[model samples]
Target: MMIYTPKAGNAPNDAFLFNVKERSDRLMNYFLMVYFVLGLIFALFYGTWLIAVLVGSLSLIAYYSTKLALPNSTMYQYVLSAVFGIFMAQFIYQMHGMFEMHFFAFIGGVLLITYQKWRLQIPMVIVVILHHALFSYLQNSGMDKIYFSQLYNFDVRTFVIHVTLASVLFYICGLWAYQLKKYNELHLSQTLQMAELQKESLLLLQREQYNEERSTILESIGDAFFAVDKDWVVTYWNQMAEKILSKPKSQMLNSNFWDNFDNSTNSISYQKYKKAVETNQSVHFQDYYEPLDNWYDVSAYPSEKGLSVYFKDITERKRTELLLIESEKKYSDLFQLSPLPKWVFDVETLRFLDVNTAAIEHYGYTKEEFMGMTIRDIRPVEEVPKLEADLAKQLNKDELTKRSNFWHKKKNGELIEVDVQSRDLVYKSKKARLIIANDITEKQRYIKAIEEQNDRLREISWIQSHIVRAPLARILGLVPLIENPAESLDEKEKMLEYMLQSARDLDDVIKNITEKTTITQNFV
Candidate 1:
């Protein structure tokens, strides 16, 4: 999907100008061999194979020796190009100055173009010109071994034109080479630039990916989260943050943090956030924003570019916490103000955890004294074993409240009977008991007195039933006998006397019974 175009698309690389360059250096070896073979083929028809072989073999030996000596150098390419011109010259001589054979010089110049350096054509051009001028002069001066051209009418005027044309052709080839070299430089510059751009593009892609992942994580979190830069500009506001703070993302992001939430400028979170940036360190704290009427748990971290802040609305939690505090206060008041004696004790240690005012006064112990004493301290010594046994049993009991009777020893060592009411409860985070002590000493005493009085009444009722009944029966019998007199007037008089004695006896018994009844009532 990417296209790379050279800066100078019309022009080619200029390694052909110089000796073979970077990637083309090895190709020069093949080029050198081709040129030498051409020379030998020319020599075969000219009867100068010996000259061709000697020159060609010597050139190859020289180039290879230099290459082996200095492998890093490209100077060998130029040497080979110049030698190519010589090969062309030999071909011209073998053909006896054939004008068509002279085109080989230009061909050699063009072939050298692969190296992309214009300067590589210089040596070859010079060699061809010198060979032409020297051979032509010699042949014109009547030298038998030299060959210039087949044209016998070839004068100085024609010779000058001929050499001039060849020179121009070589210059043109070199010029093209120079232009190619410039194109290569531009192409290299462009290529390097493109590579650099690709590197930056890759880095940008990674940054965007990281931002996306961070945004996703922020959105997924449970806490209300928002972020601000060093300039206090809001950079991010998550869904939870918008819902909790009553500000949507569109209203928050990119806005100045202070300006958007201006009403909370006086909040502690604002000051702490600024402090975090100034110190260039992370800070964590909780703050109550008055305007929002909410609390926040915040953490701010400082970075080289800016500050990053994460915060959550803690309003609901704060509200619950305040309600819990109030509830505890209400219960504390109830416990302290209750009229009945009360105390709270730790179940595991049997130690008092708290005691009401009434408990303090009734138990004859100061609040401080009670706090230091355990439940065992307030019970009679004889009751301690029983108390332990009862507590052990209560450990497995799940009842909310229990009522029982116990004897408690006051601080002054006076013992009082009490009706104890206790319940299982959690107090100040500890499993404990809340107890109410209802004193019943006087009530028990009154109950015992009533039972004694009832016993006396039962005894009086028995006396009336058995003894007084006997006297009444005797009187009735004597009265009937006296009323039945016929020949018994005297007898009636005797019976009456007996009846009077019996009545006296009955009155005496009644008096005894009355006395006994009076004594019993007094006792009651």
Candidate 2:
């Protein structure tokens, strides 16, 4: 690429020239006032105040009129040159050709230098020479009224010397003015050239910084990255790419993108990348490389010159996904084949999402019937309100719910006791639960029978303690009477007979109690 570089030179937009021009403009506004004041001051002693006013007024009118008419032009500048010379003439005439008065014309030349233009001095120099030559001739020709010099003898050599000196002074001032203007333009050009250089340097610096940052990002990223040109040439290959692809930079860079690799199986990948550049679009997709048994997430971005493709190894992610899919399949098989009366239902609608074979058999519902039914369908009508209230309560998704003795109606309309426990789960992507219901009808019947046996055993225990005690006490009292030594034979025999009757009655009571105890034991 070609670049334009600027060099320092003296040019028109010079700072010094602007300042000089400003001084010149200010001098134009008021420099003539100096002549008028001088003229008035000299007029005080000479009695020529009318000549001073007349000449001063005429010069002012001409200078100001030309300045107004040609504001943007330099015509007023030339007029000032002529007008300042006229003031010098007035000074000489007022001084009556005093030799020192000629110096005023040189001062006029110096003042003109403020304009920064040597040409403004031309008319001033011409006017001064003309006024001197004409007045000198008139004074020497016996015109005593004309004052050309203080000495009566004004020779040609003297006049020539004075003219030469005045010319040298004006020339020096004009040359100085030209040099100042030249150097001012030179300084301006250098400043502009420096500015251009700085701009170019800044652009180069920014471009270099951007390249560094881009290199750092490409190398530091976790994924592999590489770039290819429009002709399928390798351009940039980051460190990650070298490592992941197991290729060195020397082997990959500047090499044909296809030639560097086995293209037999990767033609699909190559085509994908080419299409992106051809279409001028970016594409992102994953492709499996069969040779490496690897999967890559590819992102290709197209630019005017080429394509930048990034490759990420996603083989592990793909494998994990496959494992998860297999695991879900196994889980689904377990859900369908489990022997327990298990089911899954949606929590929001209380709808049955799935049912095991056991559930369909136990609940007496067909698979199609269960599919259309909500959890409320199997619940006893009376318990529906409780179910709603339970659901209405703010329930944590992680909470376990157990309805140990809830009633469920089978298809035959028989309400059976059930021990139901459920937990939250997501089934088929729905907010649902897997529930296990245990029928407890036989258990309740057994518990009731046990309670009845307990009641009968309690009555048997009462009979043994209160009624059996009477017979045992009578027998004990009679045995002591029969053993007494002081008893007569007849009395003893009567006591024995009474004891026998008591014993017989006691035996009957014992037998009756034994039969009832046997009955109670048989019942248990």
lDDT of every predicted structure (CA atoms): 0.80, 0.82
- lDDT, model 2, position 121: 83
lDDT of 2 by residue, 1-524 (tens): 11212235633364455466667878766768878888998788677798799998898888889877766567777888898889888877888877787788888888888777888889999998998899888887879668768878777998899889888998998998788777766777787789889999999999999899999999999989999888878999999998778789899999987787755434568778878987898999888877678888999999987999999999999999999899988987997788778998898888888888999999899999999999899988889998787666626444566454578899989888888888777777798877888888889888887888777667667767876677678778878888998888999899888878878877887788788677767765
Tell me how far the alpha carbon of residue 465 in candidate 2 is from the true structure, in angstroms, after superposition.
Answer: 71
- Which has the greatest lDDT? 2
RMSD values for the candidates in order, in angstroms, are 21.0, 15.8
lDDT of 2 at 470: 77
TM-score for each of the candidates: 0.46, 0.45
Shift of residue 515 alpha carbon in model 2, Å: 81
